[model samples]
Target chain A: MYKIFLTFILSILLLPYSSTFAVEVDMLIPPSDFQAFDTPNDDGKSVTLRWPSSPSESTEAEYVVYASLRKNGPFTTEVLRINSKTMYEEGSDSNFHYVEIKPGKFFNKDSDVTGGRSSYFFRLVMMSNSENVTVNEIASATPKGNWFNWKKLNNFIILIAFSTLVLWFIEHAKKNPNLYLRKISGLDAIDDALGRATEMGKPVLYVHGLNGMGSISTIAAVNILGRIAIRVAEYDTTLKVSNIDPIVLSVSQEVVKESYLEAGRPDAYVEDNVFMAASEQFPYVAAVSGIMIREKTAANFFMGYFYAESLILAETGASTGAIQIAATDSYTQLPFFITTCDYTLIGEELYAASAYLSREPLLLGSLRAQDIAKGIIITALVVGAALATIGIGFISFIFKAS
Target chain B: MNFFKRTIPLIIAFIMGIMMAFQYYVPHEASQSLLKVVTRWGITIAGFAVFIGAYSLFHLHWNKIKRKVPGWGYSTFVFFGAGITIIFGLYNGGEFFLHDKQEGTMFDWMYFNVQVPAGATMFSILAFFMASAAYRTFRARTSEATILLIAAVIVMLGRVPVGALIWEFLPPIADWIMSVPNMAAKRGILIGVSIGAIATSLRIIFGIERAYLGGGD
Candidate 1:
């Protein structure tokens, strides 16, 4: 009984040295400058383990990183198993081999990773031919989450400066609401189109192209729609609005309804006038094409973002002898619209539609702010090109984000 | 009444606008989680929006059918198409097809065999339309159009093998045009669009633009 008790005590005492003693051959040496530290700029789920490549390591040798919650308890989990060849392939320098330790699906209380709060013990074992040849001392690190991404600081600064410019312009415009904006001919001809629709005793068809509610062009289209709705209501001319998105359809209904109310012609507002044509791309084009042919709309307004369907819609409208005006920010689809429609709003012109139509000082102010921002961007580009030509690449580098 | 109709919505827009705008800068796990949650919420709302789309579609067609409009016959096809697609989807292509597991549901077969071909046909028609548009565009009616015509020719040639046979230098010139002048023009427009988008977003965020809320203000 005494011998058994002594054996138990010795076993408890030598538990730490068992890993060292269990090595069959001391052919390997522990890597120098071993470290375990929190991985920077990431969620607290991982820590980076680093060690300088050891001279004794060969292509055949394997690196085994054993992890445990306790400092000296059993390191049951083999967190990593990689050969020295792969570690060397990552970098030719004898500097460091890095392994980011993150827990997988089966991790539990023993791993003790409470999102950077837990400090887990990690020890390395160098093995060859399935035998432990060397062992490294345990080190601990806590994986942490950072509050801010320093990389996006440049973008943040630009956004802040631009916003400040907009607000300043908007404030200035309130006092002096006559912000000079170039006349967009497409928007200018809207009244004539409406007048023609009324004269011809035919409906005015408005198609919001294939864009979601979140798109800037779509919002601009909606704003334009509101203005058109008011004019149509007052003129007592029928206006049909076709939609591809349900949200846009819902919003259009409300916008048209309110426009009718504002025009004091709530009775003339038809719920079915604004409806979802189709959700899919080709279906939407097909439906809108059918509307153009069947209604024989005197005037057609195709606005927002478009894809391949731009031509089909415009061509069908053109065939019906309607005066068509198309506006979109999609540069790729501009050629098609320009060819088929009577007038096309290109690039930034589409964005200026609402401001021009509403003639609201606040909206015009935003437009002016955008123009000023564009001037700044143009100057920056010029300077950047000059500097790059002269071998002063600092400006270009500053603009480049990681 | 004004508060509920206008002010409340503006307040909500303000909160959402500020949150999403600044969320781009935050790298924390909590910030990422918030973005994911908000994105999921948007998707969930879009799922419910399907019903709104159906309501408008059915209402439009039903009106046309009821009134016996000129194209009323076509309107009925929309119903039959939707009904057939749904029924085929629910049956799962007979679900075991005499106790043998079929490759896919009838929905998949219908999509591939019927919808895909139909979509492809519509897409194919764009080529003819493109040719027509190209014919109109390539006409050198003005000085600007002449320049456009020349540029378009170069790009078209550069994309094909025959251009190299015509002149070895032609390909390089075309490449230079695309890489430098074309890229510069595209970037210029993109910058303007981005700035416009940002300004519009700010206008909405600050409650200066109420057109989207149907001009309740």
Candidate 2:
């Protein structure tokens, strides 16, 4: 009986020591396959470190990543807790990857690393039960500037292909000089609108939209204005252009003046007719609305980028019983313009209108090229979809946009 | 004279356009810094353009008042509003232009109370206009018109809680139309617009489209 009691006491004394041994064993199992590489497609300021989780990884195990300029000693450590649910997984294997940007500042704020490029060494330590074990081999990476980013090589390829097609078509059209373009109804109605205004003896109002000179739609609007101004000059009718941007107003004045000169009616051109109304949104709409009411404009042209003011301007013009023709690239406001305006140029039609009206070889050729590009895109999309459906997704990957 | 007038401008534009386009592909720090510098220059130029616009406005209203044009009284109000706004903006209620506009300042007060309300009023008026336009255009006179009308009704009803109460399937059908047909059309337009925009940009960069340069010359 005394021997049995002594044995039980001895076992209890060794119990704590056995638990400590198990924890030490767990901590000794370090992470494996540690590697580091410079991150691509960025200014040479970041390096990525990756390592497989410790073979004895458990729910309680956490990772601490350390970095050092020199391969030996004085490492700054960053504790990283891996959430089991959110950590990335590849098949049955999971790896811990961390991107260290400007590693000197990131690992240690006091470390001065502003001089030039320097190599960085990384070590990952796995910790559990208040015990830690670091990987044996240190991984190193040096961030260097790359002249070209291979990741965006696909984007460059598409751009080059599209640009080549456009240029080739332009050159071809220049040689041929005979290309057919479909008639757009919105553009066709411009003459009729201007004619109606001339016959009615009422002034025609042309609004170059609320957008400034930077917008593509606004540029298109100005182009169309040039053509319309020439037509107005020919018809000997009054043309009033209301502008919201001062720069656009000045440009419009020059365009209109030039058009008048082209039509040999420079004397008939009124400088003040092409005037800046207001710059603010609602205020500009209000001014244009007042003009429509007061002038009783026979024909109204709303072209370029419009916002909430689209409906306001269109409604006011509609109330005047004017023949309203609108064109915009703004899809959100298309419904409003279609509802209010007599003729509305939808999307690409607005862009094509200037070319269609001018019949300039350059513009026409570019337009044709765009149509071809669209065709190619459609074909690729259909083929890619079919291939993807049949489990051949490599074609889709080839056409993937950045 | 012609060289200075046209050639120089076109050459400048070409160089700038090429540089700007190529800058996008470069990920170097120097390239990014250059882009920032160019953007700052653009902003400065835009500031000058704003001043020119303000001058144009002043000239326009001055002419209106000078001629006693039919609505000369309204022109006076425009000048008054502009003058008051300019004074408040420049003064910034004692902080001047050195510090940002603060709360309780005259500029902030006018902006929040007068400008905000007026802008909101103008925007709200669109609801009535939209209803009127819808009434005229949504008539079921043709097959296409009937389809449009039905779609419109479905979309309008689906947005409200009463729609779900009336028909359990309304919301899902509305979501389907919006997600499928509406999205497809919008994407089509976007693609077309993007292609067109690229074409236009190329045309401008190559100096092929010069109507923007002014018509005759």
Candidate 3:
């Protein structure tokens, strides 16, 4: 009886120890429908993975994502905790879990692995209660370098449509160059300013703002300068062009010389008159200001991209009692120009001045196309505002740029 | 001569223009690498173009001095400044280009003392100019001018501490004007400018606008 009682007690103690070693439940249910694909619109540097959340996942469960260059083994792993309500809500709809893995970061390499050449494999494992379950299949994807990004498809479409419209108008204008463009007050004042300078027998000073040839504003300024140079040649008045960029200085010299030649006054074109004062900002402004004061210029034309120097140059011209005409696309400097200069071209007016002065079919067509585009944009803005007021938000997404 | 001067340049411009425009849409590494190379080449070309500007400056000043122009003395000062700066920069205080300028070097001393002070002095002069410009322009002669003057006053007052002491709502009203009307005008200008720039670029690429090529065909 004593031996029997002892054996029974020993067996009860061993029962609890055996339960600890034994598997509690079948926790090897793999995630379903695993997939990997190249992340779009990238430089072949990343791949995204997706899988249906395992039904076995609970509050205590953790996910471990693995990535490998080869299809099997030697995988680099990253632990992910999806314990919060936000995580569950994010992937709740399709019971989907997604992650983007950069192969370079995965392999701890300095160079990128997904250069559109290498294939990568990924797997997801779910761990709960010390038991783990991994996906049955190793998902693989080869990131490809796309020839074109589809995400910017909307941008491309808009660009193509506008470009085609402009080109069509250009062709039409080439046949008929009598397109109606509204009168811009700032541009109309150009003649008056030039005439004043001619009457005063003082040179007209044109300061090309501090920008290089790459800026459209600078190109517009130069184009306007050509028109002004022709008029100056006809009036037999001197024109001094002060430039801050070397390339623009060279180009302006050529343009002014050509204008003089076209006006049958090639002898009047002085190369020294169109010159670069300085490359640096304040120094250039100082040099130009000094010229404005010393020459006692009767009229000053400030055109192109102006920065902090706008007010300084304009104020000096104002002090000189010159007729100042300023034009720039820079909004910050617009207030300064308006307050100091006599006539100011507000934004697109600067661009329109070129077409207005040149009256070329190509430029006229471009200006007309821009007006149409602006009208469309304004209509869209009004429509978008109305839609939003009515609690329809989808129109905003349609008009979103990039 | 015509082919080399006109036709070849036009062809090159067309090819380059199209390539640059389309390259933005491509997400390929090779295309991006090519863009980098082209950008570097452009910078290199710009570096060489600086010499053209320097020569133009020298020629202008030399002519002025030769003719004994009214400001010929100023031209002499310009030469002196430029010569000294260039000499010191190239000398590098007996060090090579790869090494940094020594602490007591003439280049370092002149850059800190002469160039910096002159630049700062020029910048500081803008404050007085701005005040004078404001005084001349803030006169309320017309209705639009009156409104602009009021807005300017409110903005100036609201930015300082004295504004809050006078009127509590001044700051918020000023903020509203800047955020609403000012912002609206700014956005309108931005959109208009972007479209205009695009149109200009298209005209250039199509070779329909030859003003950049010296106006007349």
Q: What TM-score fits each model?
A: 0.86, 0.89, 0.85
Residue A265 lDDT in model 2?
Answer: 95
Candidates 1 and 2 compared: the better one by lDDT is 1
Q: What ranges in model 1 sit over 4 Å off?
A: A1-34, A49-66, A72-101, A104-106, A109-116, A121-139, B94-103
User: Native contacts retained by model 3, as a fraction?
Assistant: 0.70
B141-182 per-residue lDDT for model 2 (tens digits):
999889999998998788899889999898988998899999
- Candidate 2 vs candidate 3, DockQ winner: 3
Query: lDDT per residue, candidate 3, A13-108, as tens digits?
Result: 899866644433444366777788998887777787777766555566677767777676666655244541123325368487766667655554
lDDT of 2 by residue, A208-279 (tens): 777888788888888889888989999999999988887898889888998898899999998888988888
What is the Cα-based TM-score of model 2? 0.89
DockQ of 2: 0.65
Best by DockQ: 3
TM-score, model 3 to reference = 0.85
Q: Which consecutive 10 residues in model 3 chain B have the weakest lDDT in total?
A: B208-217
- Please report the candidate that would top TM-score against the real structure: 2
Fnat of each prediction, in sequence: 0.68, 0.59, 0.70
- Tell me the whole-model lDDT of each prediction, alpha carbons only: 0.84, 0.82, 0.83
Model 3's chain A TM-score stands at 0.78
